[model samples]
Target: MTNILTRPGLKPARPFFSSGPCAKPPGWSADKLAVDSLGRSHRSKIGKQRLNYCIDLMRDALSLPDTHRIGIVPGSDTGAYEMAMWTMLGARPVTALAWESFGEGWVTDAVKQLRIDPVVMRADYGRLPDLGAVDWSHDVLFTWNGTTSGVRVPNGDWIAPDRAGLSFADATSAVFAYDLPWDRIDVATFSWQKVLGGEGAHGVLILGPRAVERLESYTPAWPLPKVFRLVSKGKLAEGVFLGETINTPSMLAVEDAIWSLEWARSLGQGGLIARSDANAAALDRIVEQRDWLGHLAPDPASRSRTSVCLTVAGADEALIKRMAALLEAEGAAYDIAGYRDAPPGLRIWCGATVDTGDIEALGPWLDWAYAQAKHAN
Candidate 1:
């Protein structure tokens, strides 16, 4: 794919707002990626140190506990989830709560691939699974933020106190933007692409004490792939989360992710999260003032701070398409179209990189484009 921002004399119509593989940090320079790692082996001392540095910084920036272990693995968030499932899922029956695409994928894996009997709890897009309805006695798996749907679990209070089962969270899009209840989550996974605005293709796995106990106690029902093998035969893989990746990683991507994390650390983690919340607030204000738009997530408390999904009321399909096209044509925004599986509307990435001023500007732009779309239709 061509660099969407590189068109001659045609500047970005507006700041880019795609969810994954987001726009690069404005201050990022190519010089940082040109280091001499292209020729070195990943297992070498320097490579190990580089990976260690990345994980250490990540742990610190996210305020993960010292007892928690982090693993840098090959597949983007998906791989990390699979690895966790394979290693830690058989201690009890699975309870998979799904409200969006990524959560559905996890349910599929649990039932089909692992051949494990999982009690599936599902909610339509733009809503959350009934956390109260779930039986927390079983090993629980769910997403903290439903990126495609713009919905999220409001808090971790639904988790039972002194619950016997472990909690596995696919927090790919929620990590930095939301206050994750680390005590409630046992295994958490995230990718660099979401809040940090880094390149993709790597997954970070954070494991708590309960998660480690699961790995050390039970074996998976199926055979493990080299990539998915965390507890092999009987031993826990200690270094995998530290610096020993399952396979080769894009050093360039690692470096870029490190840069983004450093940027987040410098900005202060609380400030970075506040910035995303402020951006979402800006978008919410737009939704409130205009009768033409409404948020897909009905509960204001459950709405996402990262991915903000909106739908136009009293607008035909042609109008939505035309409005999206108009924004793209003017370089006002890209990748704002709603997911194909979802009701037609708009989905904006309102994460840390997105400026509140830019989000505020979108209200007027939407008004302009909607009018044009209505006229054309």
Candidate 2:
């Protein structure tokens, strides 16, 4: 840490780094949006095509398998995940693992709301639960990335190859930013808002063959809400997975999602993941040089390349809040505050839309902000 106190003069060109509703893609503007779909029914001939376009492009960007089903669903990622739990779980003994806030919420849903006596496993904020200890004979549910903690499962090597149970992943923050072992997961859910920088209130659900089989073959005992029901009268509602959404959708938001997918496709070879990885690397260089700041995730491999969370030594949640406020007031940063439920620190989004150059600019500003906070003390 440098003792000399001169604030960095250069500010990040685009300072919007909120973890959710992340920054828009390069060259993005309201004008690039598909205005034609506005005022049109989402199920209309044109509207359906727009929706299908989003599905198509999303699959292409993710390089999903041919057998997997990708569908648009209501209530964002939360809706899709709840639907999976309501419809597919309870058919088998369940294992629920939570490392942070969102993951913990799902575990609560499984045990409390759904009233399923799941085998619960948990880890404190900066660590991962013992994946090897989970019994695969029981259906399992977890988040691939702990968004609030900025810790992600390193890989899918821990999953048993011949496991009998289904694996449901809440991948809202992991899909585009990290490599997901698709074959290992039976069902996965994500919102358009996270890595892709699209509009919210809509979610993308991906189901593998096993997941579909579970929906088709098993009948859960609990009655499901209309919004969470994926099966009707002993069968999966095929139309919902075919772009005929269960409810009316925002065509404008649909268009925005489509455009973002197209932009990802335009990146050609490495696409969004490449850009995101580069941004994380840039920020990492900044963190390595400072002894005062370090990753919240103890292990380097577990650190998220998307949500770059940092913990400053001797800083309490209150002190971190003051520093975040100082950064926001300076116009050099915005929405980079840590998750409210998380230990106090800072979280910067390094998704594809965020320029590595902006991350580089943020380095000196972080230093300046820390200095100011220290001086205040």
Candidate 3:
């Protein structure tokens, strides 16, 4: 039990720790939108330039090779991934790796919606699927970071570079915060709402040379939604990759994405990654010492630096919920509850946009909230 009076006096200056729609850049506000060319048509000269800027900024910041094509798509990361899956998957035997909810959702899409005969490799929440046994000759689909389960592939070492298959990775929560191997990933998808701390409704799709070749050569068995069609008349759509969106997009969100990218540039990729690493280290100090709480991912190497999920030892779901609710009511944290389908505990966002000071501040609040919940119960 913790004494209420002894509860740490410090609180996070920013308490916006939701896994999605994460915290804004260090100094972000609507005032930063002054430069946005709002009220203009998306296809207008200014609007198109703004959209293209978002693409270029991310490409340069994330250090994608010149061989990769970047595009802004609708419906966030889901739409972008579905587009790639619909366009390129059936051309080869597919393997869908599942360790968390989103990865499982992809498995469902392949098996049920696409009706493709997919080899599904699944694992328990905190564990990663076996990387060594995967057939690299088949198209491989997986999430680089398991946001819901707290497990993440440490690197791209598991991927075979010379394989016949294309790797499609859903890196929505992993990008920007972690160093992703763009060379190994043929098709990658991420939403602005994740690590970048931008508004949603749009997703960034990165297509490597191999992924583009598939788009140009292979056609889907089913009709692609207008938004999901990446190719037309046997050629990659030139306009789509150059900011001619499938539908109207929010200019404000586009500006926000641009702003976030600029922030990343100012800090540099290494600096941005360091911020997340520091936050994770801050969390580890408290969690490692506490026997009551442990990381959901038992393997420290597989633990995600971005979405640091945890499990409380000997605590039931109700107690976990109560602790989260109490923390929220007292304004110590927000959206810190574990993903609904995951083991009940907490899912703290330790991405680059989050200040390490804030994460350090969070440690005591969790302790205070835990004691309060246990005593009240």
How accurate locally is residue 208 in candidate 1, as Cα lDDT from 0 to 100? 91
**Candidate with more favorable, higher lDDT: 2 or 3:** 3
For candidate 3, write residues 1-377 as lDDT tens digits: 45754766887899888999899989998887746479999999999999888889998889888999899999899988888888888988999999999999999999999999899999999999899998999999999999999999989999999989999999998998888888899999999998999998898899999988888888888988888888889999878888899889999899988998999999998998999999999999979778888999999889999999998866788888998888888787999889999988899999999998888888878888888888888
Candidate that scores best on lDDT: 3
**Highest TM-score model number:** 3
> Compared to the true structure, candidate 2 yields what TM-score?
0.97
TM-score of 3: 0.98
Name the better of 1 and 2 by lDDT: 2
Look at candidate 2 and give me any clashing residue pairs. none
TM-score of each: 0.93, 0.97, 0.98
lDDT of 1 by residue, 30-131 (tens): 786646665677788878888898898898788888878999987899999988998788778889998888899899999888878899999998898779
Q: Alpha carbon lDDT of residue 220, candidate 2?
A: 81
Cα lDDT listed for each candidate = 0.83, 0.87, 0.89
Q: Please give, for residues 1-377, the per-residue lDDT of candidate 2 as tens digits.
A: 43437768788999888898989888889998878879888878888888887888888888888888998989999999998899899888999999899989998898889998899999988899998899999999988988899999889988777889999999988988877788898999999899999989998889999998999899888887877767777777877877889888888888888888888889842777899999999989998989988899979888888988898877887788778888899888898878999988899999998998999999888888888887887
Could you tell me how far off, in angstroms, the CA of residue 186 lies in candidate 3 after the best superposition? 0.2
Which is superior by TM-score, 1 or 3? Answer: 3
